[model samples]
Target: MDADVWTERVARDYDTSSTHMYAPEVLGPAVDFLERRAGQGPALEFAVGTGRVALPLSERGIRVAGIEKSEPMARELCGKPGGEDVPVTVGDMTTARVTGAFSLVYLVYNAITCLLTQDEQVACFGNAAQHLAPGGRFVIEVFVPDLQRLPPGETARPFHIGEQHVGFDTYDLVNQHLVSHHYTVEAGRGTTFLSPHRYVWPSELDLMAKLAGLDLIERWADWNEAPFTSASRSHISVWRKPPSRTGTL
Candidate 1:
């Protein structure tokens, strides 16, 4: 991901634009799932953003740390209440290393797609594994590629249409590339932001986990533990690092 993309303006306005995601119905279940799997203490979040999940999770008494590529975003997170308690490393999630290990390492809200390439995505999994203790779990929540929903020869689709904001995604099917275009009207002014992503299949992610020496343990349609099916538009997946047999990682 380009750190430049998340400027101070973007960081400042992020929470407001994504207010719906912070709703109790959406955030509560996600935090509950992570807290349950977060074993004794610490958890690491990738692309922690404006401390959305990390803050609440920490409030729940879990020790939360984060790796964020954007200084502006990290600044926004650090400025929040109780945000100071959670340490954040400013660097690439695919290569940055935080001190010590964690019982859980997670990348939520489709952050993995930000890597843009299969190799980078796989490396991100490896980095998560690097931060995990033996027997620890690595989790991710991401949208499933909806190519099936795309009309033949159609390159773009609208994902959100609202009075305050509108969003659409354009696809480059051959390269597995997608760019989400968002336009929002605020205070009688209009602004736009475009975010690029690399869409990956569920099976492809499983293979990435295997390459990272992690084992898939569970897959759910949502944080509510609903069964994931072919019709599911998104998924939450958990992969476990093998327990050390020789007292070595």
Candidate 2:
């Protein structure tokens, strides 16, 4: 996470600018999916911006903590209605140590892409695994890279072209690097937000989990449990630590 990029200005406007994601229709399903796997969590959210998902889980009586690198974003989250109850540590998700063995640890909304390197992402998986007890699960929600959709000579794809926001992604296929350009117009003033990410294939993520001693348990196209297919745009993946036993294998 880049604190320099996520300035106070960005954090201040985050909730208002992305109000659509706060809608019950959008957050309800995500919360439900996580709550089910929480199984008496103590869930930990990586990059828990503005407590978008954490507070809701807390509302449902699930203990939720968070690791956020951007202090402004974490401050914005901590000030929410029930935010104070959800303890947040302002630190890197890849290595931030928070107490408690979580039943579920999750990174949502492609936040893993922010790591911008294979090693950081792999370390993030390790950290999540470190925080989990035996039989615990880790979840990640991320988009499938749109390389297939790009025209032969094109390096960018426009995903949103609405009045409030115009957004697109530019790809560096050789390195699997991606930069999302978000142009927003509000009150006659326009602002541009450029977020860089390293896109990883689903298979790569599964291998990362395996390297961390986790097993792939389930995968879906969405929080609704839609089947993940070649045509899917995004995916929700689940991996579980092996059940505890008295003796080692």
Candidate 3:
């Protein structure tokens, strides 16, 4: 599904359903990583759902803006304190444009996979470059595709199993596609939601960045800057645009 469809459906319950992501242990390091990179400059987020990272980062004294496809999600963010001050452009992150340049352009929590096509993902990199000042950084947090969890001939792998929620990812190896299936139970009622995404490798992302005139600067296992190794489940990657140089016209 596209961002508009899936994100709108998930908006109402996103904060509650994704509570684990907002926990201090998980969120603190992420905010710190971005805060250090952003310094005193402005930062822009792509697919900034419900202001999960932006709000707190703003409270740290950095200017924050966002590009979100779902109006419902943006509305939810606007309802929060200080959310009214955030300038959000309602459009596809791949093509959305906001005024001025940003020192950091970030997409966290596997949001890049939501684009579903390689071309769209590359376009997203280009869009991020367009919004960034020279020498600015683009950061992404995403899970590494874990095909090892899939047994021989198995197409689906369960990633989460809990009393209230069960989640699995069904892979299409040929197309590099995956659909996350989530079943949530509450009050003895079950609801299922399927979100389509295209899994991308770190090398492929580096190429995308290079195509947009950026260079890979860092790759960590997590927001805490752990060394990225083969056993790591996810990564926080950063790329930077080259600083401008003065030249005689």
Candidate 4:
């Protein structure tokens, strides 16, 4: 499918369904990690969808701007309360001018996978580096691919939910990418969403960061700073722009 068409379909249902889609509840912890390391400086959110973390983070008094590629998603964000205050540019993250240096630049909700290629993903890190002040950090939230641990016939795994609508995500792993089929069924309505993502190893992401002149500073299984272990399902990785350009890692 064309990227434009795929984006359009997501734009329409984003607020209604996608916003509430992710489970294991990581937003609070992700934001909290940023707050602790971000200092009192400004922030830049890459996708800024529906101002999910942006609005709440801004309400906490963090100055924030965003680079949002989808106009419809930006428009949806603008309609929310306090949404008018966030400064967002509707353009591609790879080359978009985010304006002003920020102490923190974050792309949450596994948005980095939206780039579809390693080159594009690496470019995004470069773009983030260009907009960061010295000592600023870029934080990324993503799920580690678990297919290698499962059997060949296994595709679906029961994911997060309390007790209500049980959910499962089925994946087709080919090459280094995963074609995800997410199905969550409620009492009456059932939703199935397709998400095709390029899965990256933690070491590969670190290399990408290094290429952009950033160094891996921290890695956590959760935002609460849980130790990164093989059993961890997701990761919040933080990279720092060196305070001084001594070029020493």
Candidate 5:
């Protein structure tokens, strides 16, 4: 499914189903990291769904804006407390343009993979760079593709299994694509959701950032600034637009 369709379908349950992402243990470090990078200027989120991180970041006195492809998801954010204060542009992250340059631009929770093509992903990096002021930072939080977990012939792997929810990823090795499948159960009823994504390697993403005129500054295994090793399941990467470029040219 495309971003709009899948996002609208899952917006209602997004917060609840992804409860672990919002827990203070998981969210605190992310907000802390972004707030430090924000440096008294505004920060922009590429997919600010339901104000999960944006709300708290704003609470810390940083101005926050967002670019969201799904109106339903934007509405979900708007309905929450402090949500109206954040201006959201309802459009694709690859091409959306908000009013002012931001000191920090972020895309979290593997949202970068939602762009199902290499070109789109590259364009997203360019877009992020376009929104950043000189020396501004862009942060991305995404999972490292774990093909090792899949046996020779297996195309799918279970990532989460709980009493109320089950989640897995199905891979298309040839296309470098994956579809995350989620099934949430409530009172004996189950609902399934599929979100399509294009998995990108770290090297490929670095090239994309370079093409967008961004330079890699740091990469970590998590929000806590842990070292990124081969065994790490995911990464939090930061890139900076050079101080020379003042605007999108």
Candidate 6:
């Protein structure tokens, strides 16, 4: 599917289908982590779709701000309960000016992969770094791709499972990207959706952090501080900016 079309359709159903599905469960721990690390002064959320995390964080008096590229998504956010009060700029996260040097800047829910290019991903790191005060941190949540799920030399992984059972499984692995097809059958009807995603190794993100002049501070398999080991499937990685060399001058 075309990117624009996918984005447009996603903007409409994002809140109802996905945002509401996972926000509270994810955002609760995420906010707590940021507050503990950065003292909850000010924060910038990249791709603050439908105020899923932003609204809850703002309610904690964190002085949160957000950047969003999709106008429809922004509009949908503005219409939510308590959402009108949150300050969000409608622009690409990599190019938008966040105004203040934030104590914590974050991108969650694997939204960074939406950029779909190494250059864009690198620019995202630079932009996040630029928004940080000295010693500030950037936090990201993403899943590490599992090569074991893919068949050799094939970009497609066909898979099917549901809340009840597994019907089939297939994965498409292509040049650092993964797409999954999960098919569901119910009442003599079958449905399928292609969920496209880019999966980067954790080490690659650390390198991105280094190139952007930030250093990895901590990594967790989950928000609850589960040890990041080979057994883990997802990660919450934190990187901190080094203090300026001229501070003593």
- What ranges in model 2 sit over 4 Å off? 246-249
Candidate 1 achieves a global lDDT of: 0.93
**Highest TM-score, which number?**
1
Off by over 4 Å in 4: 1-9, 18-25, 158-172, 184-191, 245-249
TM-score of every model versus the real structure: 0.96, 0.96, 0.94, 0.86, 0.95, 0.82
- For model 6, state the Cα shift of residue 162 in Å: 4.7
What do the candidate models score in CA lDDT, each in turn? 0.93, 0.91, 0.90, 0.78, 0.90, 0.74
lDDT of 6 at 220: 97
Local error of candidate 5 at residue 7 (angstroms): 5.1
Clashing pairs in 2: none
Q: What is the Cα-based TM-score of model 3? A: 0.94
Please give me the total number of clashing residue pairs in predicted model 5. 0
lDDT of 4 by residue, 25-46 (tens): 7467656777776779999999
lDDT per residue, candidate 1, 1-249, as tens digits?
888878888898888777668989999999999999996758999999999999999999999999999999999999999999999999999999999999999999899999888889999999999999998999999999889999998999888788878888999999999998888888988778888999999999999999999999999999999999999999999999998996533
Residue pairs with backbone atoms closer than 3 Å in model 4 (clashes): none
True-structure lDDT of candidate 2: 0.91
Model 1, TM vs. native: 0.96
Candidates 3 and 4 compared by lDDT, better number: 3
lDDT (Cα, tens digit) per residue for candidate 3, span 1-249: 275554556788777666667889999999999999997789999999899999999999999999998888898999999997787898999998999989999999999999989999999999999999988999999999989778999999887787777889999999999999988877887777788889999999999999999999999999999999999989999999888885211
lDDT, residue 113, candidate 4 = 77
lDDT of 1 at 171: 96
Candidate 6's C-alpha lDDT? Answer: 0.74
TM-score, cand. 4 vs. native: 0.86
> How do the candidates rank by TM-score, highest first?
1, 2, 5, 3, 4, 6
For model 6, what is the error of residue 226's alpha carbon versus the real structure, in angstroms, after optimal superposition?
0.6
